[model samples]
Target: TQPIIVTTTTAPQQGGSGSGQQGGNGSGSGQQGGAQDLKEVLNSKVSKWGDANGDGGVDMGDVVLIMQSLANPNKYSLKDAGAFNADVSEAGGGITANDALTIQKYLLGSVTKLPESYAENIKTVTAPATTTRATTTTAKPTTTTKATTKAPSQASGQKFSVKNGQNQFKGDSDGYSYEIWLDQTGGSGSMTLGNGGTFDTEWSAQVSKGNFLARRGMDFDRTKKATDVGKITLDYAADYSASSQGNSRLCVYGWMTDPLVEYYIIEDWVNWCPQPQGGSKTVTIDGAQYEIFTLDHYGPTILDNQSRNFKQYFSVRKSKRTSGSITVSDHFKAWADAGWNIGNLTEVALNVEGWESSGKANVSKLTIDVSGGGQGGNTQQGGNTQQGGNTQQGGAQVQAGKKLCAISFDDGASAQSTSDPGYRIINALAENNMTATFFNVGSWIKTEQQIKYEYQKGMEVANHTQTHPHLGQLGSGQVRSEWEQCNSKLKSIIGAEPSHLMRLPYLESNGTVQSALYDVPLISCAIDTKDWNNASTNDIVNTIKQAAQNGSLEGAIVLCHENYATTAAAMEQVLPWLAQNGYQNVNISDMAKAHGKTLAGGQVHTRA
Candidate 1:
């Protein structure tokens, strides 16, 4: 069994041991409770197939230890077994005969529903061996000299001093005694937990106690305030030696003051490291208090990810509370885009109560960037990159998974409706079994036969604005007519109103559009194939192909209009080339799902 080590705490002062567990919790857990709202699959359940020891999960090696006490006639029963002097609750806590029956049923596949949470916090999953987080670590210095006992000194040019623990620190300290941890994808570092969750050992001196405390704001208050100060939770997975050292972790959460927001366990990390101490400062975390850690150790994926050039999905935070791995939907660009922009905010939000439940006011900070309407040559919105979750479409050979992409003909509209080139491209896509999104023109639906063929054959007939003008330049009412006219034409033929899904002529729109769209997500390209840029046909295909090769545009959102014949000429190579190179051409809908964007109410929207 892994050792259950606990974090040490300050005794009303730095390097001191106060008492029982801390009063509050981490900041990350509160962030994670929102996870339940964001997920499709639950990560909290244990794997039914992971009974490696062939024992029911709740059974023991540990709890059901026994010896036969035969009472003659070779007929022995557990009825007369000598019981330990523990209470009835302790005896009942051990495994029972009914537990065996449950496992037996589980293996038969009769077990359908999973429990609400994991058996115990969460276990560490060694991520796919193909993509290792650790590179070969340099060996520790070999010729070592005997060292003398002394106080734990901070590293040179050190920003903070260690109060009570030994070399290296981990976890947040409660006013009492506890340690929260951090994610360890970066690499290994020193920790603060001692043996068996106990911190009763003596420090070389009285000034070495430690804790990790940080402050975060609430949306309602926006006044830049501190939150519930508390210790983080840790789950040590694998043990390295007799000392029980293996994987170390921590959980962060949002805390509330006043009546107090019930704390939830948020995301946890396998390895937590120290932050740099350049412009370091202190803030109280909870009412009892804690020392907050900030930008020094902030290693969010978005802070470094680049958009268009880099695309991805996300995995679960690996903890007790999570339902399953979360894909921060392609529509939801946070760590990728949001994180980059958040770095520029000058003011911080204050901790407001009741935010843990309903907090739409907080997102107002985001609305400041939305343009009223009109424009789309280059983004005035600044290039921040996509959100960070897990890298998508992985290959043992490449960095991420097979990227989902699409090629739409928009032949139904555009001036080139009755052309031979676009028709030729359609045949090519069909022959290739390329599942494509085909947004139609109002004029094409007038051809009753072709309109029936498109809607019936599973080609997605989303709207491309009726007149195909820059809707951004139009007034809100005109934008409504643009969508309504297109919707009317499509409804006349397809017999159903369109969802008003669109890919702008210039692939443009503005903040003013929300009034027209019930809730349609705007489509934007991550990596435009750029075929319309007056570049040669080969240049367009080559640009995309080269991006796939150089591993830069792995999750590219290449845009091409079937309205052009050059795109048709290049289709032959583009499709086959991406496949030969191992790219998976999924529709926009699937890509959105993989990224964990919200699907409608039983109305799964398809946009590739």
Candidate 2:
């Protein structure tokens, strides 16, 4: 069977008296004529950036139009001319928040002109040049390079399969099931669901009630909160065809309970009922972009379930895609940010809804990789755990005799630290392909970009209190604020929260401090370089060299700081020497893993 092809284009209106152009909403007596006029204006080649209302002007009205379109895409679409004018940023192709900010800056006199590379609304024509003797010359054999195309894999039955006949439902592999409910009284067509977990099935159906559905996917425990789920991913490919009077859609259905709400990620839709609400926010997940739409008070489930006040968030692709993977967790985050109190995730299903349509969809691949907190699961636990049956005050005990050493830097994200000495230390570690743990002081993090660069380059960013105070001397509340504030700042800077590891300032901690930090493990140095005492380069190198010679470097946590020029100079020699002398440099978590230990709060890990 041939694949279904979908096209989107605005048709010209018939019998329009005049171009009754209207802005904001695409509603007017001559809506199609307005579109036609906009296309003509674009063809005339005289529009500038930020002219979203298509009135040939760059002003606040244009900004308002763009904002309104973004807030409600269904009511107002950029379509063509508006899209071309509103896209003024370096992003080049999309009308996004960045473009809106650029327009605002221009209005505020922050810029003189828009981006030079912005596409102009001009249609250039090249007249064919007249050639005299070229036609007489023998035309050499033209070389055509045929584009290579990969054939889709044939569907195979492992645990799930589908076919045409009366509606049926069955269970499949990996705790998944397939269900097809069709109202045959309205229409007729062949429906077959096939493929292992790697692909989707081809489905065709006709119905008047708009109730034909073919579902294939798994259901998770709905009682677990969204925070507990780590990652959910779906990769699929779909094709649809209709008889001009038919309608169909391919969507991923996730049913959540407690409040009984449904979440749908629609891959494609054609002439479906209950038109989507306006306003769309774009998000990139798993390298694919999706336009998210939210609808509230949509009323009872599509399956005619009990009527309950429910909300729905649909993440639809900007364009129909044949194959792409989406990280479902990110969408959940976006919904939550929009004030949707998402309860525990219950069911994750990928299916198609059709009305008088015929076609097929292949899942190709689908995966739900859930990690972190869940129902009855502890969210404060770190990723690494201790080996053996030994239980320490924090969590587990580290075994001895592991040839691993953790190199840590402390108190040094300030401008002074990131200057010559800091770059020197960072360069030395990068050149040596060594990984180090940085316990950063929150207030000292002046160069956030540089710190994020280090994180991207494989260095671990842990917590060192905000003010580097003596935690044992501070009150319990102050201690908690110090750590929590530092963590919050780190997350804002690097988009990650270091909930697993932290080191107290001046290595100061007591029962109160430990009690306050019961979630993050306390990391103390097994070998203190004493570089903060203004130790000379030679002195610092000798301190570590002596430790290595004494065999105390095994499974050792070496503490140093980038704040000192002497420390940076010493590392140039110490790091290479450690590598040559059989000591493997790693982060704290890795060192703990090597020694069969799990890191948790309340316990200090010291080399034995």
Candidate 3:
């Protein structure tokens, strides 16, 4: 599907909880099909238009599908034909949260029937649920009269509650050092530091505001530069539940000497992130994009209670994730590239900070390490950075003698919304512990986050073309440009272009196309499920089942499109059936690798 791009403007301003970031929400006119008359769209009697899940009714489940699709288009999307019915808010407008809201209003009796332009009048409608994040412009207090530094307590569970002032503790556990700090103003909060990288914090929402920062990592002596502090990487997993009125941030927090700089490599946050003045600029680091912002703070600091000013440098992630590996030095390099000064490192640690919010967070796993030189720089803690044991596209070890099949999708990346087919397909594959290759069209690609999401989910992200043109009819130069541009975009997200495979648009290729992509292996399917033609889900499923029954499924590539709802539905049945019948679903590259076949470029790979 070709997504409609909407352009919006952003005004520079100070940090506050208004609209955090300004960009197209991926909802616009001219999607799925061109603009249609509102009356004709609403009066259609062919299908249950609003039934997102095809359950014969439009209900909360439909609303939920839309919401989940918006939040995570890769996993829960409405690529089915019913998506047309889901686009109710605006005639010919793509399926968006506005459509979800329209359905919600109908169910709530706010509207008797879905309106043609409900999106334009949704200004006063309060969302059923909302998360209130901290909008306070005040800086967190860094100095307290109750500051204390102590060795690791022999006791395992150490807890403290602060009502009005400040309490800070420094200790070491499991060969790693940690610090817990809390300061409240007209409020109260509590924190419990467990062994190693495990801790929990709860703050009072009844009062006005409070602050908490828990750190686990090396603390410098304000003598060495940030680069000299060594390679810093943090892996953490936590469950953070917050009230709607405050803010929560998970980051690599540190202070610097000489320049009096406070730096934050914010990996994730709750609603309303700190925007800083003059807005922010985008930068790519660690194979993902981040927004760089600088804010000035005037107040007491960690070193003293005297009023002083300092600059806060931030590397906020564009795609926020709760649990992941953070290469802290990548941000350091990015900041330096942006002409930001790197001062003497005073402290560097994995920190969880909450302000003016009544909520709780339980960190089940966390690890922070510094290599070159710094405090808490020990290597006693086992280096277990694997995230829940899921592997990347080529990282998974194939079991010997396992029946392997490749399921490939074309015409992606989908827009970041509920109707996105890529997300839905990715989620389904993940649920079954399988993976596939997404042959994404360059023009259809939306965000770098989408490509990153695919790779992060252990799926192969490949190139279809820049414009889905007939590569077989184009010159070699034109053909090269198509795949080259798409490869470049994918590289920006996943750190490398697709190495093992490329699929021609509509499988239409010739000598020119082959010559242009001579160094990139081409993938051909052994089985075709023509769900893109609006084939019934059962028919698509049967096509694959017949292939397996004929003993031609092993080491075969099963072709389909994630952009079709019918294809997604067929996969729901096909994946489990494949698994149950002793077939392992994998991407083309992995399938080849599993069979010990050398996937040389310039040759078409029809099977493992």
Candidate 4:
């Protein structure tokens, strides 16, 4: 049993003792009342999931403590007992900002339970009884240490310090790799790396100065392309302020090798920012609009100090924000669609850069997750990468314990007809509260409205080749052309390709087809309903049921053709049966994520 420790301002009563027990309330009930002079003698127990401050409540105060512990562990680190209590993750890992995020979700009613469901063996105690004398009680308000800590003294012997002239520092900070580059000719710049991927920096005005940038992410040797690294997503939080004069940019900055290009997804800036010129475009990402600018630069880059002609790409946000998530791959796709070439990645980092500006910035949280960029690996630091809340499909939460399966329809022929097989299939799936994927051919989709109707029903539309050619007989160039044509048509209609998935005509994939589309995951199927072979509706239904009886339907990718009326008729019976048996019909992407599997590039996936 764990003893309940209480801090009180008023003196204990002078009688023998008063004993009482109360149910655990997470409303800061352990604190002594300020006006009433009632001492909160906590005689209750709580699980160790979220009570970070040891105050006997899982409330905002606990959340603040967990965040503080991550931001500045030197002074606010939870030691021994507090450390054990702060391990709130369901995985029972060490303390991180994710633990605090989980507690915040719970306090905000986003989650009903903490990761740990077991009750702690906390012991409770009673206080001494009433005294006759009047006592003044002063309540101590919970305070969280701010992220902006003063610059460390030289005696601390931490790492890099602000100085004049060019200085580049590289090492690990709070379990994350970081690099700091200061090119100040006369100004002053200070940097301090903190716990759990946090950084604090300050700078003074300087003339004839380059720029100061502190970053946390990859500083590669220009050997790997962005695709070689996989999909990169960044989650960041910071407090940024700068003077009106001089230029400053808070962004995700990187460089490319072969093309010798530089890029910036500028989230916030001070005073002025780069603007899009002629032939430039705009793309919306993470709920904000950004103007894409392409221009030439003839100067030294991070990779090469010699003068060279290169390109600089900018996705400067029209409006600014200090905290949010960025799906970096979406920007890559948008740039690629606009006929701009991106090359081998040299650096991908969250940068706080100032050009002769005087200001301070504190990045309290930073996390980058790179997964499924054909590298077939996942890297996460300083946080939990799993998305918060239950697994979601079609924007609705899937109930716990239900098995998930992806149902796909192929060959989108005559999808615009009112009697279109896709319409019936979509209606049937919707009636049963499910969704499926439709592999569409470019030419067979008669109108954009046909694709829009499918999307309106929460159905995913994927690529099935432009003309549905036999892919095994095609050369690598031909296969790529087919894929590109289909994707181009889909993007023009839907504003984006359906997913990173493509199905071959007749499922006739060979080495050439695989080699040509090495960056896309070819989706195959485990169960073929064969509804397109003039099979009766009962035959299609029984094929699926037999697979379920054999225990092969769980997490399986089931295939059917969208050109057949019999397939739609069969799904009327098949979808309801699956739902009744505790199975959820999801698209391929959702099923892959649900089963802890990644649909990596250059691979063929039959089941999740």
Candidate 5:
């Protein structure tokens, strides 16, 4: 059991030692005291699943109680078994901020159940009788420590103050050491490196609220082949103010000496860097998703007069998790499979990089498990050797000799149809195992949940103007307003901005419209179903069938309206025909990628 300290202001009553004392009623029955004792015992047992106050429910109130205890350990207490219940981590250690985060994740629906121990203990506990108590109030505890600590000192010119022992490099503060001497922005924090021998190192840090507290962990030798070094695992706990507007990250860093490239696997919140080359692909490892990116560095210098020519690879986690273990080798394998020549490993490090943020983090363990011997194979040289393979396919490349087609529905959630055309269209596409793009009108969105359902079902929800206006005639301001309103609505509904693909009303676009769009790509279809004109279902089907036979449908973006019942009827046949004809029905984004193109800002795209 963890230690529990209880503080009281009033002195204990005389003649009562761990026994019942006479109250204002002047009565102290032995049976009444026994019942009270039983209630306390039951409360202690019931509190073991994040119910810190023993109120029989794990909610925000319990979270607040735990925070209070952390803030003032002496004045406030977990009280009996509250500490055990609060240990939500799998480690089953004492209560920490990670336990609070686990409870938060449970409340947020990210996690469906508490830790295993909490469930196991709750199943065996028995309930106690309830009792009513007289009203009483206690004074608030005095503030001994501020909720936020002051930023650390930053007069030290180094990124982090280093204390170099015989075989150790320890950091005295959280700082940054850039290859180029950029203007310094001052901030303060502290970190430590332990077991800092020549080959092994451990790092931990507590960053008091500040701005741009970027620091690197100690570097480990990376002279051996990657296969020989089986895996590197990082066990860590991190917490930051959710209200903070800046970015904070904990990531593993690898540097290759030959190509002078750096690879980073990062878990970040808010903070970001420019990826001029853009993201390549997303890979899932250990059930966590990561977005990979590569970029060439164009800096003035590389660590004080070193070469500035280098490349960078970043694998950023899709979601922020406060506590977990990362298998570094799996990420490397993903990049290697994607044609990234990782080259010979030279230095490996874990870093806590922060920018304009206030937070704290702890790394409990860092272990590198090595297996196998160096096979004595010649090291693959050059920066571009690993840049082959199926990297393009991992993003959106279509197989050679295979044609790509995109099916798109416009003006979604229309009120004209007898049934939900969006639902029916999605069902047809899903049955065929295909994905399409939907251009939604903001006003037509009856409920955000409907849009969420479409997005969740693997359909791309894009912007069609707020009221489906003709951008060719609308002024620049109106065009911006129309695009912004629709994008904002989609973001609010689906928790992300719509894919930067928009279609002009009636396909009416001009230079003015194009300039107004700025960065958003204009999506024009290769084949027009003309279902908006109330074409017969057979006519719609025949148009697509003829296009496919004539080879016009190959690498084509087909346009149909979700508001029309004929379009939905047409897709019931068109999707199966495309699948049968050796065509892969993909979204516009995928189709663009298949053709070695990006569906990004300022580009007008049409099907081949």
Candidate 6:
């Protein structure tokens, strides 16, 4: 570097003394530098060293100020500083021109393109050292625990239950758990937990109608043949009497062709008239004794036509069964008549469209007088001729032994009247907490919400044929279609077929509709009130008042449509009037049982 500077100071053309000359201290170099004017110009254009604000010159504290701003950006105002002075702003934070120069210098071997590469020489050197140190470390282990749980098994049996689990459904473990009691023995028995009581969970003591059931997991197999079961020795005399007049008790005993959940019925006659009063039969299964005490399935539904809720009560005095014969002994026979088959309904009731498979009946404090319509008595607009009454010129049929009664209402569920007087009548009924049988049209039950609302409100949706036609009048195919469609629709909308009762469109029929009821019960009315013809309120009330008195018409099944607002209004007068009288309301289901009933044409899984 020094040699080059010396050469520039002593150029011979400048006429100044050369560096090698005696006066070459270079003070006289100014004379020779006069020709090189470019040198001065070049010095003037160089970048300022410390002018951090980029005004092209270095200041006293540029570097220090840049460092201070980098440490605390808030201390320096971006607007007052240029890129050179603002470290964050100029370097884009920490980037700078020097960094780029360093990278470029590394890529070029000598930082300035190998120093023009005229001539270059490189040297190598090395250094080494040896050292050692050691230490030990320990690690911790992990721990974990796991838990296991077991699920309980369900009990088996075909059973019936109630929501409350108290009255009307005591001594039965219906809801506290899931179970179905099948092939149940009719005789008395008891169960006591002994030793550890072979069950997975704690056992709940159980009893039913004085009979006991062993808990699940017990060694006594689930499918026990009760054909040889002992008798349910009941003290009949304690609660039963023979010579009782109007308020006699009747014990019902029957063996199911198949396992059953409950005895169901269709016609109001079956429900109202315990007409099938008294008789007994025995079946010998494997020489074991099985007895069925059935009343005549005829009477009120047959020749008499008098609809009466007649139930005969019997107490079990003794029962004994051998492997060869299961014998049942009871005395529910009270009335003068007795028959095992209630025979075909037509043979029994003379004018019955046909036989109604099963039915109901009840004996209570207040006697009831049912019109063709259940409690739906009072009004229907027939014509100007019969404006004051709900009666037609039909023969007396239904007979009620009890003094109290309630009528069932139909047509209230039709789309046309769901909210009119039909609706108001229901509201009125609700005001009194009254209940009635409402045979619904299949078409109306199109949604789940509708069915749920009706059920929650305590209104029963029974089958009124797919359409409102006299079922007996349709062809066999049409009849089958009617029941099938209604059943399917009801199942979809209501979750199950209430399948309790069915009414013929006109108490009119042929053999076709009859056969379709293998799983549905038949509900034949006790009387023909012909409200569809528009019987008047006064006529309805008066006819019902007489029905309560007349023998054949005592338990008459009343029929009424909801097309007119008059029916709902009329019920107000009739129902309160019945309550004021000796009449009491009875569920249609209970009424049908008196007739030995069940769903006729089909069966369904009653359990989930």
Q: How far off is residue 303 in model 2, in Å?
A: 45
Note the Cα lDDT for every prediction shown. Answer: 0.31, 0.54, 0.59, 0.59, 0.51, 0.30
Q: Quote each prediction's TM-score.
A: 0.35, 0.37, 0.36, 0.41, 0.37, 0.35
TM-score winner, 1 or 5: 5
lDDT of 1 by residue, 1-608 (tens): 01111112211111111111111211111122333331211222122322211112221111111111111101111111111110011121222332333333333456443221222321121110101111111111110111111122321111111222211221111111122211222211222222222121111111122122211211111111121111111221221111112222222223221212212222233233233243322322221122222231211221111111222212123223212221111111222232311111111111111100111111011000111221111111211111111111211111135554555555464333534455555555555544445566565444555545544444445666677777668887887787778767877766754433565556554434533442343444434556666656797788777767765444334566665667777876687777767675544433333333322110112232
Off by over 4 Å in 5: 1-402, 415-419
Ten-residue stretch with the least lDDT total in model 6: 127-136
Over 4 Å off, model 6: 1-406, 415-419, 444-451, 473-477, 549-554, 593-608
Kindly list the per-residue Cα lDDT of model 5 for residues 1-608, writing each as its tens digit.
Answer: 01112222222211111111111011122133344453343344333476654434465445544554564332233442455466564323345556666776775678777652332222212211011111011111111121012243331222121111101112222221111000123333433322211111112222343333223332222223443345654444544332245555666765653345677887755456435376478899879888887888764221221235777878888886656777776876787788877654533445555555545544443333322332111121111111101011112223355566787888875643335776788778777766677888898777676677667666777888899876767898898889889988887887754666786666665545655664566776656777877689999999888978976677677888886677778888788887788876766655554443333233244452
The TM-score between candidate 1 and the true structure equals 0.35
- Range of the 10 consecutive residues with the lowest summed lDDT in candidate 3: 130-139
Question: Native-vs-model 3 lDDT?
Answer: 0.59
Superior candidate under TM-score, 2 versus 6: 2
Q: In model 6, how large is the Cα lDDT of residue 16? A: 12
Number of the top-ranking candidate, with TM-score as the measure: 4
Model 4 bad stretches (over 4 Å)? 1-397
**Could you give candidate 2's per-residue lDDT for residues 1-608 as a string of tens digits?**
01111111222211111112121111123223344454453334325666664433454445544554454342233423465577666323345556666676776678668642333332211111111100000001110111011122332432222222223222233324344454534433223434434434444454455346666655443324554456665555555444445777777776664455678877777776344667767777556787777778654442222254777777877676555666677888877776667765645567777766665555555544444443211211332221211111122122233255776888857444446676677777767656667788898887887677666655667788898887878887888899889888877887754534677677655556765664456766656787877778998899889978977677677778877789889989888887787665666664544433334334444431
**Candidate 2, residue 53: lDDT:** 46
10 residues in a row with least lDDT, candidate 1? 134-143
Count of backbone collisions in candidate 1: 66
Better of 5 and 6 by lDDT: 5
